[model samples]
Target: MSTFAVHLSYPSSPPGMKLVGKRYVSANAQQEGLPLVFTHYTGAHKELREPAIQKLFDLHSKRPTPAIRKAWAFAGNHGEAGVVNAGSLKSETNGLLHSLLSTLPPSSVSYRAIMFVEPSLITREMRLKHKAERRIAPRSCAR
Candidate 1:
């Protein structure tokens, strides 16, 4: 059986690197290797959020033609005590989505899930579309 794991590492990535530093679970179940996904989400950027979300939608809509899977946004605005929020930035989102799309499973040719800490574009109405968890931390937790 394949094991599924998702690691959360907040405030670990440095600036200008382009990734949010969220740890990825290993499908091997016996391997100790993990990877990071980058996003461009910043809680404060209302302008960028809409476009980012739209871009994500476009990316995911294409199922048979190169799709996106899991993703993470880099910390855009760091809160007190080294707490940064990177859940909707373009640079970070693009990076993370690109990585996931490149490594999609053969059986599943398209995106099935999108993970983010906080997505400004996701309105309250959209939340009801799926079984998503919304909160102060990790904004968009949809699958």
Candidate 2:
């Protein structure tokens, strides 16, 4: 099977959601905080190959996963505007290399904290890298 390293982040929580003991809870008793509602931002290294990732994103963007759809519905039900918006996928070739190099003994890869940023804040190079990554094969580059 193909293995991929991915980073995901949520820029903001729903309006009524509150951080309670490291978990988000909704003001509404019937609904809980949708912490897994991370349809907004995602990043992947070249380990997954660019075209495959793009195709996956295209397919899912048109028809989001069940979890994403549920998050959208939850946002709408709570009248939380702007919680669900079009997000971007980044290609972090340099970041990926850095992450790999930062790895210590006994572990093949290093874990980096997720970064939360506004969709508008994403750089042009990141977008361009995303495009370029999609064209290259996942295993073609140095691992």
Candidate 3:
């Protein structure tokens, strides 16, 4: 379940779909008023047949699990997703981390992969620290 409520135009949608996760943001106001998902798709998708995009959106919108919402995100500056685009990314990430922490786990290492589209944030310090850790080098400077 998500942290916010959703109201789809379809009257046939299951009532359970309207229920969002408990709004346990713990005082982070930015977490409020954000749409449940953002598909930041590239313009290349425009090449697809017109109905294809809408169909895909409809398919995914039917399943509002947090992980699916995160995966459905694409990379375009226009369309349904706007500033809530970045906010959705941050909020979903917070949810993932919190879920992990809440679960007691066996002693082991955890890994995460992120995609960053910028390069200016990549610095020598980041490179050195990463190398010192002896882990695989990251390919992006995503924050």
Best of the candidates, TM-score: 1
Error of 3 at 143 (Å): 24
lDDT comparing candidate 3 with the true structure: 0.31
Local error of candidate 2 at residue 118 (angstroms): 4.2
RMSD to the true structure for each prediction, in A, is 13.8, 15.6, 17.0
Predicted candidate 3 versus true structure: per-residue lDDT over 1-143, tens digit per residue: 11332222223322222212112121212322322222222332212222433443354456542222211223222232223234444434222212333444455754343333222355878767767453433223222
Q: Give the TM-score comparing model 2 with the true structure, all chains together.
A: 0.21
Ranking by lDDT: 1, 3, 2
The collision pairs in model 3 are 2-21, 39-74, 40-74, 40-75, 40-76, 41-74, 41-75
Candidate 3 TM-score versus the reference: 0.17
TM-score of every candidate relative to the true structure: 0.24, 0.21, 0.17
**Model 1: what TM-score?**
0.24
Candidate 2 residue lDDT tens string, 20-129: 11112222212321222222223321222334333443444454332111111112111112222212112111221223224433655443223343445678888787
Residue 64, candidate 1: C-alpha displacement in angstroms: 27
Ranked by TM-score, the better of candidates 2 and 3 is 2
Question: Evaluated with lDDT, which candidate comes out highest?
Answer: 1
